[model samples]
Target: MTRREAGLTLVLMDRLRTQRLPRLQAMHARVTAGDCLDAHDLRYLCVSLEETQRMKSPSIDTREAIRAVLARLYHEITTQALSNEQARFRHAAH
Candidate 1:
């Protein structure tokens, strides 16, 4: 790869390590603990999902690993969120 491409990839990886990874890990912890995601959390995830679609390029070598974690997070969060909604619906129905 050219120097510029290498530099950009490095920057992207650094951002992933420093910013995205920590936040994702935290959210994973929260969701795994049965806490519902707030509006800001949902919005952040929505934007991240959108960005991930756009970020699928050759330079970002760790994309698959990141995506795997993201998929797990999505599963946990959605499962909890759906459970919460179902409980609310049942409560209302009663």
Candidate 2:
């Protein structure tokens, strides 16, 4: 990646960490706590994850590592949401 690309990626990563990640974490917590997540929340998480995954760093290894961490967090949020939904369904059935 060029210097400009690396700078842009750094800015994007900072924004993700400072702004998007907090909101995503909050929503994940709510979902795990049995609060319903609307379409907007899901869309935001998906888009943010996609954008993070696409970011390019000056170093290939650094970029891959950063993407891996972000992707893992996104995956955890998804898994928690799915587990919550299943639990809710089971409760309803019971």
Candidate 3:
């Protein structure tokens, strides 16, 4: 890769570590704690996923690692959301 491309890759990786990863981790923790994600939180996740698709890092390992983390996050978020929906349904049926 060219020097400029390498520089961009470094910037993307740094942003992932310093900015995106922390936010994602926090969301994962919140969902794991049984808190239903709000619409804004869901929207952010969608946008983040879309942005991740657009990212072009030269490191296959880094991309795979990010994808794995995202998959886990998606799972937890959906699981919590499902639990919340079930609780609401039960509440309404009573």
Candidate 4:
């Protein structure tokens, strides 16, 4: 996706994370023994989700921080990645 699209997506993701993430966490917590997620896996998801939310902060400084983070993430994912993966990251979110 383009940077504009990615920025919009990041905004939407941040809005949803505060409301949806906790519910998702609760559901996994309530799952039975048959279902399990390792610490690393869960932590990765949490961190990723947190970044999404952080990117949409009302503060300008926070937005700049998120933009930097997004650029790094975009670069990391685009070093000969699939088309879809490339479409999923933004070089610098405006």
List the candidates' TM-scores in order: 0.65, 0.79, 0.75, 0.30
RMSD of each: 3.0, 2.0, 2.2, 15.1
**Model 3 over residues 3-69: C-alpha lDDT tens digits?**
8877866787787779877898888787767667788988988887776775666778877887888
Local distance difference test scores for all models: 0.71, 0.81, 0.77, 0.50
Model 2 residue runs over 4 Å out of place are none
**Who is ahead in TM-score, 3 or 4?**
3
- Where is model 1 more than 4 Å wrong at Cα? 1-6, 56-62, 88-94
Better of 2 and 4 by TM-score: 2
At residue 82, give the lDDT of candidate 4: 38
What clash count does candidate 1 reach?
0
TM-score of 1: 0.65
Instruction: Please give the distance, in angstroms, between residue 79's alpha carbon in candidate 1 and its true position after superposition.
Output: 2.3
Quality of model 2 by C-alpha lDDT: 0.81
* lDDT (Cα, 0-100) at 89 in candidate 4: 47
Candidate 4 wrong stretches, greater than 4 Å = 1-57, 80-94
Q: Say which candidate scores most in TM-score.
A: 2
lDDT of 4 at 94: 25
Q: Pull out the clashing pairs in model 1.
A: none
**TM-score: model 2 vs. ground truth:** 0.79
